[model samples]
Target: MAQGSSSPGDDAGNLDKTFREWQDDGSSEVATLGGVYGGANGVNHMVLNVRDMEKSHDFWTRVMRLEHCGTQGGPGQPRFLRFYRSHGHTHHDIALSPAKDPDSLPIPTGPLQTPGLNHFAWTYPDLETWKQQVRHVVDTGYPIQFRMEHGMSQSLYVRDPDGTVVEMMYEFPEERWNENIEAALEYRRVLDIDNDPDYFDPKPEDMPLFDENGLAEAS
Candidate 1:
């Protein structure tokens, strides 16, 4: 009998034969260009469920440095808080919803034994912007768990009121994106900028080759 076979003559009995049938079906396509051909433009917005809407709103707008755009619902009812005042003109970049259960735990309610959304990252345009972010967090007295150079980017992690991790990152120079791609595919290892002292403040010569046309030119 086949290892996985329910019956001796069943096609599903042989794993190898079942795999071959899937490959020969010719119902799938792979992109030779190796990128999202028609993917989403970017992350539009995110919603977080919290025990106290007022507290979450204050943390997001003041501590996290986002703008309080507008909101729906009313006090003592199901309230929603919106933040987009400074970030962009979008209706809301991030929003908060108060937990319906008044007695729900203030901390994350997800399973403690299993891995879940470790964190979500937001990127800044350049080092200066990132530095400004650092200043804001410091001034607000928001807790900073860690700050480090992650090879391809510099990052700071902060915990919100509900103990959710939010990562603030500044991407490395775009000219080096090709180098990042090559390193990721070939060595399958993250570039550790922390190991290099100069990574903190690069010189002109250390800059990666970049043309206005973009990666194709640098490559």
Candidate 2:
């Protein structure tokens, strides 16, 4: 196993053995290229270059619910800000940098629309918190992209001032976590709300798993 790899059968002693074998296979060379493994194991924070630092900062802290955690510099240095969730151990969960000119950024091209970061997800502790998040989005009059229930999680997608998608969600009850994986694969479901305006009023519900014909009953 790699340093951060996981397997269903992994256990204390077995995991140590796996890591030793993996390290001896010449695969760990690149990871330890700069003295030690620098390969990403999990998300730490995401920094975005935005049109206006103050605007992005306000949106992230006030509306998106991240707390202003720390600051640097007095005036001349590059403007930067760090934010973290109140209950999280990480010093910062999100950061921002000012872009000299956001309008001059090149537009993506082609039918496939090229490649870019589509969205990032933030999880709520539970369903009640998820509902509060939905209400806050509605209260702020933010543009909602859609709502989805993936059996494992319930989500709300909203657009920020910069038109970047932000996904807010909460994991479904633990009882539903063990649902049949085959059912999910066979009958995928999603709520199409691109046109409906009242989609955010009531809380969303998980749609039934797809049927043999690949369709779910309308709520």
Judged by TM-score, which candidate is best?
Answer: 2
- Per-residue lDDT tens digits for candidate 1, residues 33-132, read 1132222256788887777777787888787778777777766675655445436646777777776784765565343344666678888877778768
The residue ranges of model 2 lying beyond 4 angstroms of the native Cα positions read 1-41, 74-76, 86-88, 106-112, 178-219
Alpha carbon deviation, residue 89, candidate 2 (Å): 4.0
lDDT of 2 at 90: 69
Give lDDT tens digits, candidate 2, residues 1-219. Answer: 245344433443355555566678867344321223443356777877677667777788767888888776533476655555645576887777666778997533222244778788888887677778787876887666778766556678766556667788776554443445455444423565656443453344433434344434534
Q: Ten consecutive residues with minimal summed lDDT in candidate 1? A: 31-40
**Which regions of candidate 1 deviate over 4 angstroms?**
1-34, 78-81, 106-115, 182-219
